[model samples]
Target: MAAYTVPKAFPTTVVGSYPKLPSAQEALRRQRKGEISEDEFKRLVREAIRGVIEDYIWAGVDILSDGEQSREDMVVYFAERLRGYAPGEWVRIFDNVYFRKPIIVGRVEWVSPMALDDWEYARSVSGGRPVKVILTGPYTMLEWSFDLHYGDRREAILDLARAIRREVDEYLARGAKYVQIDEPALSTRPWREEAELAGEALEVIFRGVSAKRIVHICFGRIERILPYILDYPVDQFDLEFKNSNFRLLPYLKEYGYDKELGYGVIDVHSLQVESVEEVKKAIDYLMKLDIIGPEKIYIDPDCGLKRLPRRIAREKLRNMVEAAKLARKEWAGEE
Candidate 1:
């Protein structure tokens, strides 16, 4: 998304946020309680990032991430860093799961780069592979947070977009080649209503920042956003095909969604590690659909692997890399 080169066919990557190492998680918890110094916590997180980068390189992934080891949660992490926001009461995100959702206390602004150090650290350890910076999209950030300051949703979302664009611009200026904005809310309920706002926000974030910009939307009603989503200002639309049993593939094909795809070949929500055969089959189905080719796809999990155990996530990535290689060979008639 710095000096772009054509990736190998079926380039294996991730949607970011791998399962945190036990030591890193413990360090975070201790830091929260003031039992560990900030410097110590950061050292642990950097170690975790190095470990993650090694795993991806060893597993043969083409594109990689910092694995978001330092992040507490996607939305909360960015919210805490940005100006004019504060943590609100604990709120449930899923069944029996709660997070400290932020409330917008004033006009949102970006005071500094939120993900630069980690991205640069990952790059140093990534064996020269492309490491993407994953930022929570402005729309998602606005949607997840309580808007006490800006009563108008458009005003709040656009302002957040302006804030995130600065982060994106910084990454581009600093030589980041890939950047992804996670916007699961784009496919959530009332998605039709939010599509226009999301588009406008995307416009701001990507206005002039040119990298391999990606928009990842998973685990929601993707079918509803079809043709409309095809127009968002991103180079790729990373969606969940494995989670929906590839049911959404037909729509993308039907809508002629013609951009690079971050293909979901692994299911992260499931504890069972996907066999290489399963991952290959998923890739084959997309190829069979004939809407896009291997060169235009990035083999990946349905979403971030934070929900799985660390071992399970690693195994899943291993299988994914194997599957992508297998698919690549077959596509080339090398096997």
Candidate 2:
């Protein structure tokens, strides 16, 4: 209903949060059953990651990930891999639904392989299109885990920020030119009382991580907290557009903020494939806005595609890439 106000440019790209393949899932299951040694597990994981990398490339996805499918869940996997962080208990959000929780046991520390392996696998698969190094944002870790540390939540966040900062530095030095810090929960807070808190906390964690920093917020209304997300000093803001928050684009553009936007057009949750026409309509709506355009926009699904059926996910992504090409043709007056 409102006008989109972001700029547009050539060379739009699409990315989604898709999972790894069947082999990776099988290896994880076997390892959990104690049928494989740690070394063997790592070897399997490496092979699985390579597979994911290759698949994304073949699918024409400009950006690639290790699929993150074998990692025992992103946050918990990192908690187990890092020193001074341990699985504590499970926490419930809705009835009978819970996330495996971790606690900060001491000063945060990152063990290798978790960070190193991700970087290396990306390098092995990347044909120089700039693979994104995905890491859980500090705020997200604090939100998902038990915060029984030496001080208040803010204090714990700063500590985590420092630890994440170290990880970012290491990854960057190892040929990681693009990085994604996932903070899907930050937008769920009461924005009025915590805008500065969220903004400042992200400010600290994002400091010194120069490589195309993208803070991803989706699958929730955290839309009400866009003021905070917009305030943070980062390169891009990736948010859900096909889902409920599609209405937020006008407000984002109205504020005259100039950061790049990962404008999600495909619905990741639906098995019903999105038509190229639907994606085009969404893009057309945004393009009509004064602030939004090709240069400032990147196409994506409403959220990660990991939960959807692999076939559906791949189709949605394929449609998205084609949709981008179509948008380019129409925008250039070639269609």
lDDT of 2 at 238: 81
Compose the digit string of candidate 1's lDDT tens values, residues 132-210: 8899998889888888999999999999999998988888888888889999888885466588889889999988766
Per-prediction CA RMSD (Å)? 2.1, 5.3
Regions of candidate 1 where Cα sits further than 4 Å from its true position:
1-6, 333-335
In terms of lDDT, the poorest run of 10 residues in model 2 is: 1-10
For all candidates, the clash counts are 5, 13
Could you give me the TM-score of model 1 versus the true structure? 0.95
Tens digits of per-residue lDDT, candidate 2, 92-204, equal 65568566788877766656646567557656755655557777877787788776664577776677766777778777788676678787777777475565665676777
Among residues 3 or more apart in sequence or in different chains, the pairs in candidate 1 whose N, CA or C atoms overlap within 3 Å are: 1-177, 1-178, 1-211, 1-212, 2-177
